[model samples]
Target: MLDPELVERITARRAELDELEEQLAEQLAEVRAERDELAVAERVLERIARQLAE
Candidate 1:
């Protein structure tokens, strides 16, 4: 059987990892949203450039 203290330490580490994962997921979502917004802006600029070129 695993030592009780070892098991407790493992559980604590797992919780810490879970919290980090949650934080990273939130950050990733924000980055993706910003990327999408930039993509839209890029498209608008491209459209304007095409018209200006004509």
Candidate 2:
């Protein structure tokens, strides 16, 4: 059987990992949103440039 202290340590580590995972997920979402916005801006800029060149 596992010792009580070891079990407690395992539980604590799991909680810490869960919190870290949540934080990383949120950051990933923010990064994706920024990337999408940049892509849209790039498209607009290209369109304007083409219009000006014509």
List the pairs of residues colliding in candidate 2.
none
Poorly placed runs, candidate 2 (over 4 Å): none
lDDT of 1 by residue, 3-28 (tens): 99999999999999999999999999
Over 1-54, each residue of candidate 2 has an lDDT whose tens digit, in order, gives 999999999999999999999999999999999999999999999999999999
- Candidate 1: C-alpha RMSD to true structure equals 1.0
Candidate 2, which ten residues in sequence have the lowest lDDT sum? 1-10
- Colliding pairs, model 1: none
